[model samples]
Each structure stands twice: as C-alpha cells, then as structure tokens.
Target: MNRDKVVLAYSGGLDTSVILKWLEIEHNLDVIAVCIDVGQEENFISVKNKALATGASKVYIIDVKEEFVSDYIFPTLKAGAVYEDKYLLGTSFARPLISKKLVEIAEKEGAVAIAHGATGKGNDQVRFEATIKALNPYLKIIAPWRQWNLKSREDCIDYAKKHNIPIPVTKEKIYSRDQNLWHISHEGGNLEDPWNEHDKDIYMMTVNPEDAPDKPTYIEIKFEKGIPVSIDGIKYSPANMIYKLNEIGGSNGIGIIDIVENRLVGMKSRGVYETPGGTILYEAHKTLEKLVLDRAVLSFKKMVSEKYAQLVYDGLWFTHLKNSLDKFVDNTQEVVSGTVKMKLYKGSCKSVATKSPNSLYNEAFVTFGEDDVYNQKDAEGFINLFTLPLTINAIMKKEKNEKEKQII
Candidate 1:
C-alpha cells in the first residue's frame, strides 16, 4: 500500500526538522521536503542531506532569489508599504511567495496535503494557510504546532534530541529568526518582553549604529519606472543590486527597526528587524517620487501605500483588491523614474538630492528670483477665488449678529 504523501515547507530549522520526523514516525506518512531559497545564506546540500537523514522521502530546493526581489520586494518597495509605519513587510511578503511555491510543488508531486511549521499563535500560520487555501482549496492543511503534543520550543528541542536530529538553535540563542534578500527579522525569547532591550548580539545583518564609522557613505541610485536599475552608475540584476546595497547599508548601519506590531491574529507582538538594502531602496524611491509626482497625487498615493501595506501584512496578496492596488501602484510609478543621491550614517539614510526628467518642479514658478515665468499679481485672483466661501461665511455671520443686536 502507498503511504499518503505530504508536502512540507521545510526550512531545515528545528521546528520543521522535528515536524518532518514526526510526520514520518508518528503519522506514518511519506514527506517531501520543499525548501525555497530567497537569498538566505545556507548550505543547500546540507539541508537536503539532513532532511533525507531525518526521514524525508525526497527534497526539493528551489532558488527564487531573483523572483523574490523583482516580483515581491520591488512591488512593496514601489508602494512604500510599511507596516505600523516601521516594518517593511519583509516576512509578510515572503510568506505568500513561499506558499505559492509549496502549492506548485504539491500539485506537481501529487501530494495529498501540505504541512507548515508556523506556530498557531503567530501571523505566519494565517498567511501560509490563507495562501494555500486561496490557491488550492481541496488540499488538506497540516499545521504541526496547533495539533502536536510539543507545547514549546524547549519541547521541540527535547524531541530533536530524542530523535538525534541535529538542529541549529540553542538555549543561549533562542531567538526565532527569518532572513531573505530583503530583510532579516528576530522574534521569540527576550524579544517577548516589551521592556527588555534587544542585545547587540541578536542582530545578524547590521552592525550597531553607535559602532558605525564616523564618516558617512554616499551613493547614487537610479530607477526606471519605480524599479531600481543601477547604483552609482553600475547596472545590476535585481538580486545582485540588493546584495550590494545590503553590504553597503549594513556596513553603515542603515536599517534597524524595533516594532510592537499588531498581528493579523489580533495580538501585539514585538520584533526587531534589519532591512539594510530595503531601507535604502524605499528612501530613494520615495525621494524620486517627490521629484516627479504632483502634490495631490503624492499625498493620495501615500494613503494608498498604507492600505497596500496592510493588505500584504494581512496575507491578502492573492485577492482582487491587492491586484487592483498593484495596478494603481504601477500606474503611479510611470513617472517615478530618476536618480537619488543619499548619505548613509549611523542608521540613517537621508536623501540629499533627486532629479527626474518627469519632475513637476518648475524652478521659475516657485523661485523667489526675478523671472517672467510666474507673476506675483496672479496670487491676488487665486487667493480671492480660493477663499470665496470663507469670505461669504464671515459676511453672513456679521449680518446675523446685526439682526440679533436689533432684536436685543
């Protein structure tokens, strides 16, 4: 008899490794481990070997770094999608892409169900399951944390020990972290306490801002229709561009954010994120937009950016509304082509200059210098027309007060 096959979103981490063994030993199911690489630094060969040694029937390691940057990261960057005005939606957007791959593999392998390592308490469970359901409603979903007897990470470690599964996490470094091309996120352990300041050792991607160099680093980033094309006059592919920026930005302590964000599951959780490259890209993109976009359009798009951020954070990427928002964002990006010069120092990326051929800024119109392009007399008629309703309201109030005085 053929044992039921299940596709597992395996990361070769402790949780997923334990789950892989449990699915085989306890449930008697054949497991196909799928690991999607989004630019995380890991030994794919070791990951595959460990999964096989731990009981996976097969392993599939897919490289999606380019797709992740161009499709997921760039769209969010162009939209300026920041969760709670701080988080860059790094982990949020990664989930949908991972789930998509899981579904695709499941279909190809004819797996009856899909399993994930996301804990029930976290937002990732909802994100993974939502994407899975949206893509394939008939497939069974197995979330090990919700159903398994292991109640905590400690228990998971014990199980790994009992089964002799080699894992990466240790008691001294128990922070659960997720990393990719866009950013690195730290959660769990000491981060659960709101008052506990994150230690410098917890950060993997960036140096501490105080430890950064005294001098600043400057770079020019060029964009075409909101997509970053080059940096410092050197053209790079999407993945390589982010890799280079991550190196430069991390050296200068460019992106570090500590946030207590409201989870989609209706709970507030705190996490520290390191998004060196993404931070630079977002600042450059917004600066260029300011150069090209009109005041009203830019203001309204800021509102749209917030909504778009929420949608991505809430795992609504596969929906019609999100698609429509993407179209709107793409339309707005048509004029968002330019180069922005920035200074990176002590965790800050400040735009010093920006230029775009589509810029709406007219020097003569706003300049105080003598020029025939704009006449000062034009302000008189404009102000009168603009304030006509206010003037009428004041006159009516004065007349009503006079009538009241007569009555008195």
Candidate 2:
C-alpha cells in the first residue's frame, strides 16, 4: 500500500465518492478531493460535506465556470471544432481544463500523485491521463478502475454500501452522465444497447419537442471572433450569456442528439446529448462565418476544424500541433465580428439573417439580371482558357484518327 498523499478529482458523484474512500483503505493514502465547478448545476455545500464524510482529508471546490467559457469554449467555437459533424464537444472541452486544475492542486498540496475515478473502458480515462502527463510528466497517476478488481456499477454500489459511503447512483437511475454549462450527456444502462431508443425521461436540459410551446421564439446573437457576446441586443459576460441561452433554448426544445459514436478507445458508445446554449451558439457562429470568410479560407478552415476536433476529442491539447492550429483559428476570427438573428421553433433553430461589416458577399456583382458591376462578356475568354486542357486533348484525338484513316 502506497502511503503518499493523493489528490482525487471529485465530483460528489457515486464513482468519485467511492474512489475517495477506497483510496484511503486500499492505498493507505491521504486523499485531497478537488472539484472543478464548470457550471454543472450542483450544490457545492452538499458535495463538500459528502467528500469530508467519505474520508477526504480536505475538499477544494474551485469555481472555473467563467474561465471554462471564455478561455476553452470560445477558442473551440472559433476553431469550429465539432466532432463527427454532430457532437458540439461539450465534454471534450471541459476535460483538459479539469485536468489542469488537478496538476496545480497537487503541487500546492504537496501531493506526489493524482487520482481519478474514470473507468478503463471510456474516453475519459485517456483524457485524464494524457492531460496529467502533458502538464507534469513527473507526477504519478493513480487510476483506480484500471488497477482495481471492481468491474461494474453493481460492484461499486455494493462496495459503497459495505463501507457506509453515501453514493448517489442506484440500480434504477444507472445512466452515466456528465454536465457543464455547455451541455449534458447521458450514456450507459439502456444506452448501452444500440437498438434501445432514448425515452423522454433520459433528457434533462431540454423539453421534448412534442411538449415544447406552440409559439416560436425569436432571438439575436452577437459575436466577435465567434465568441457570443450578446443576446437580443443585451450584452452579457461569457458565462451569463451562455447560462441565459441554455434556459431559453431549453424551453424551446432546441438541442437534443441521439448518436452512436466511435470512442477513441476502439469501442462504439450510444448516448444522448442536451446542449441548448451550445446549439444556438454553433449555428450563429457558422452563419457569421459564411458572411465574412473568403471561399478558399472558409473551406480550408473546415479541414483544420476536422483535425482540431479529433485532437481535442482524443486528448492532445497541450502540444505544439494544437498550438499551431490555435494560431490559424485565431487569424480567421479577425473579421468574424457579426450578429445572427434566429428563430427557435420546437426543436429546430434556423438563422433568419446574418450581417457583418467585413462581409465578402457583394449583392450587385452576384445578381442574375443587368448587373453593371460584373461584365458577362468576360466569361467567354475565362471559359476558353479554363477548358484549354480538355480542348487540346480532343483536337489531338481527331488529328490522330484522320492520320490512321489515311494510313489504312
């Protein structure tokens, strides 16, 4: 049994609570529980109490919500890093930030090792370990699930009961969930079965489409470099804006996705995500990009975003490659200043209009009828030059055919 003080990433959930106590008994280590609150809608007082009661020597509840939004979420939004063209990557963005906190707390508390409760089978195990290694290569990582004989949620519950550790998870509500200001994701239980459909009860943040209001809700989003700054002409801080949008978007049933995604760990998992604020924010940012970004730059950025999403989702943030991608994404956002008006009806969000001072869309030149700004006659020479290779190949074929006939 290792007797070094270990810092555990605690969320006040069943897995974390159990891990806290188990670390004490199994490793004979003094556990320092650190909770990074990224606006996940939880009671801190309760979580702190639960941690102390479960054998945590101390508890550190850090409020990183505003930083999570402005520093992490905004950068990814500007980069347009959506994984698989469907996921907004709410969970992906939060992982690194949480892991960064772990590194800092470990150094301050004089702990030699960092502990986490991530299961061996999930992407989070990779995320936590990768970030810890990247930040401080010397620090030891204690992944209990990988080292322990505990196999399932049932085993964990039984262990928790045996030790008198209060756990939130039960056999009935067995869904594994992660929530933040950006989104909430649900997996496990029925979601483990690919054929099982997500019932209405699985979702928390958004209303069901059938249960949504009859009237459509209209709102406008303002942006500077793809970061949302305002809603309906009212300016707000990054955290406040996102919080407001989540409430408004949730009421309209604006964000819900059921997908079977390929995990980085070489397995496929099916889950449902509720990302109300993030959904509207993504739509607004994309609409503004169309108005301002040039054709070639826009297409190339799409390619970059694909790579960026994979890097972030697979847990490679603290590298030089990700840093270079950040520079490219930052350069494009110089002219991404704009506002997008949208209509939210049922579970759908549609852009009514988009405008930007740096817009590349020239109405006069693109008009079909009688545009003096564009010369239609110029197309004759352009098409001839563009088709030169094809024209030459055809001429060569004809001359070769005539020579073959003469020889015959």
Stretches of candidate 2 exceeding 4 Å from the true structure: 1-3, 399-408
Model 2 lowest lDDT segment of ten: 194-203
| Candidate that scores best on TM-score | 1
lDDT score of residue 170 within candidate 1: 88
Task: State the lDDT of candidate 1 residue by residue for 1-408, as single tens digits.
Answer: 899989999999999999999999889999999999998889999999999999999999999999999999999998999988999999999999999999999999999999999998899998898999999998999999999899999999999999999989987778899999889999999999999998888778899999999999999999999999999999999999999999999999889999999998889999999999999999999899989998898999999999999999999889998999899999999989989999999999999999988999899788888998887899999999999999999999999999999999
For each candidate, what TM-score against the reference? 0.99, 0.97
